[model samples]
Target: MDQLEFAYPWAFILLPLPVLVYWFVPAYRSREDAIKVPFFTEILRALNETPKVAAGLLSPKHWQRGMLILSWMLIVSALAKPSILGEVQTREDFGRDVLMLVDLSGSMDEADFTTADGSTLTRLNAAKNVLKTFIAKRSGDRFGLILFGDAAFIQTPFTADQQVWLSLLEEAQTGMAGQSTHLGDAIGLGIKVFEQNPQPSEQQVMIVLTDGNDTGSFVEPVDAAKIAAARGIKIYTIAMGDPTHVGEQPMDMEVVQRVSQLTQARAFIAIDQAELDKAYQLIDKLEPQQYSSASFRPKITLHYYLIAIVLALHLLIFSWMTLRQMFSRAEVANE
Candidate 1:
């Protein structure tokens, strides 16, 4: 039980006031009525023979009086509405470590993007749209971001603070991390970030988004994927852009698939904004790991309602008794 509102319980001191009133107040009694008869001896005999009706009706037994008093006290106490409070606890399940690896290489600048509304957009703009929504939906999960081109670096550390991560993402731009894709280095750096966090039994996640093949990196893509697999990291790859366009080379889907197979993850080819959106939506369906802490104040209260009902019942009883006494007196006066 918990108290939703009251701050001080000392207000209950007023409860005793009603008890004191009930204890001191005198009970109602009717005035004595006198009767005269011609045969004094016979009248006295008759009076002795008659049952003591007034004593039985007007003055109840001691136990009955006690019951009335007890009933009143109970009613008053109920009005006080005492409350008891306690704490409640709950646990959440969340287990996947997520790293968003974005390719900021020069090739990502290709204008092959179109919004869901049919408006033309840049690849960077389209990626941001999908990524922001994805981040927002992952509550209670630890996440990080990696941006790579000529070099790879951790843009944000693994954290549960989605707002801060999204803010850093908004500031991310092409060439800010350099203008050539280092796919292996990006994956390797993502692994390093995840390594810093505590490892759970479930697999960690690496989502790599790239438009071009690996052009700059000391590490090989296959070797990076092997390292990630050995560490139980699942890699989901997204290859962006239309391969059929002139001067646009098709991304190495076989290499991407090989990496996915090695790391026990999936690979996706997003030729346009719509495909990218669908790919991300699929990832969103996969739940993330969560951790949480809660604080509580407990209380219990039901006295007020009980008291109200009791008081109303007793008031009705008292009114009926008073009316009966008045009618009896009126009948005697008429006789």
Candidate 2:
């Protein structure tokens, strides 16, 4: 629990107003004719009291005076608006949701991606390196991962935890799911994952990276792209390794281009790490990081409780005075 604070501390200045009035203002009086009783003088002499009582002060009993002062103090405190202040916390509003659909076909093992330092890495490793950098730069984006080859598998669901996402990404290996490429199945799986979550994302994006044509899939790649397009999901395609070469694991440049075109996104052909980095850089620029932050403290008001206490005190004092007066009247009647 945090410390109590007042909304209007200046209200305390009114606490002494009643005292000031009592000291300076005179009591109200009215004139009346005195009774011409035969024993009035004798009664005053026997009681040893004077009869010159033209004016008198209306003073309350000690208890009544204390209660009145206490009630006034309570009213002032309520007027001040006491409240408890809570600690401040921050919240971040994310801007986008990005899903990466990576291809882990056997062809990805080709050691053809040469970096600027004259070092060679497999296609999957190269893509992973570029992706690590890219994902880090996208600060306010929720990311999900889909690895596909013989079959498609979701490695990580949508999350803002970048470290956990990267950890899952590292666990992926070439041909782990299967050696054959199933681009259409992967796309379908990605769409199904989005449907299952159904969480509202500001912007939805899917980046598809592959090195081979769709060998066998229940749904065709272009048809899957059309479905994704209708669902407002943009698909960016990346064809790894030399696009011109035709071998056992042939690159499907046409399919990649068509998929990107149908979904209103871009396509890239990366033969080296530099080109891969440039592709991610372009996408980063296109979908720039956007977010906002705010801080606030919770407040609990206490004035209502104070008002209730004042009401209870007034009722207590009223009941006590009423009972005392009733007993006093009964005693005089018995006498």
Candidate 3:
């Protein structure tokens, strides 16, 4: 805990001053009292009466005076108004559960890609390189991998185990699943995987990366995207290939655009490796998770301070009472 300000802490110092004055100040009383004794003359002979024989110190009024002084000390302490100020903290976790749908058709084997560094590489190899980095950045997010060719298959289930997912990505090869693109089946499989865990509607996400038009699948790309939207899932489509490359059909832009519009998602065209990297970076920004935080202090103990104050007050009161009793006995003997 921390102190915001001292309202009137200095007033506490006056607590002891009142008690000191009470100890020194004498209580004066003016009253007439007549006591008839059988032998008044003999009593006067046995006892000595003195006006200033420490009678103030020996008076019963000292006890009553001490009580009044203690009351004032309590009042002063109450006026000091000591208080404590503190802080509170809170934290929240928000992340996306993404399913990566990759097209593993024969066209992906075409060697017509150039990295941003101007290095030549196959389309599949360049994609793997950039995808590894993207997977590494999603620390708290659960991810799954799907490879679609003539058929779609789950390479990895939804998990936060990025290392396992990256290893599976490295093993990906052209025509490993088959020689044709099944875009619709890949999305359908993605939906099934997401349904297994049933995450919050807003957190479910799907990203489709393909190098050619869909040629295999019982379902169509547009219909799959519509189903995804109805389930509150967002789909991002990426078309990967060069339009000018010989014997390489340009990516299916029309299908990609239609799917994106139906799902309320964005479509990206990566003609080369540099564009592929930028596409992933754009998705990273667009699907970012929201976060919130708050801070507070740990608990502190204050029992010792309270105990000390009580003990000190008790000692002071006990001392005053004992002194008053001694003074009363002395006054009676002198009379």
Q: Clash number for every model? A: 15, 0, 2
Question: Candidate 1: where are CA atoms >4 Å away?
Answer: 1-94, 198-201, 244-249, 286-335
lDDT of 3 at 13: 85
- What does candidate 3's lDDT look like per residue over 1-335, in tens digits? 37533357797788778557768975665554355568776766678743232222354488667655666655565566544554555543537788898888888887888876777887788788888889887776778899989999999887778889889988899899898888899998888887787454358889988888778678998998889899878899888775444113555677789998888889998878879989999999998854334566534434344445656877887898899999999999999
Measured with C-alpha atoms, the lDDT of residue 197 in candidate 2 is: 70
List TM-scores for all candidates, in order. Answer: 0.58, 0.70, 0.58
| Model 1 poorest 10 in a row by lDDT | 49-58
What's the CA RMSD for each of the models? 14.9, 6.6, 10.6
lDDT of each: 0.76, 0.88, 0.77
CA lDDT of 7 in candidate 2? 97
C-alpha lDDT (0 to 100) for residue 196 of candidate 2:
78
* Candidate 2, residue 60: lDDT: 89
The deviation in Å at residue 79 for candidate 3 is: 39
Error of 1 at 169 (Å): 0.4
State which candidate, 1 or 3, has the greater lDDT: 3
In candidate 2, which residue ranges exceed 4 Å CA deviation? 1-81, 196-199, 244-248, 303-335
Model 3 misplaced stretches (Cα beyond 4 Å): 1-94, 198-201, 243-250, 291-335
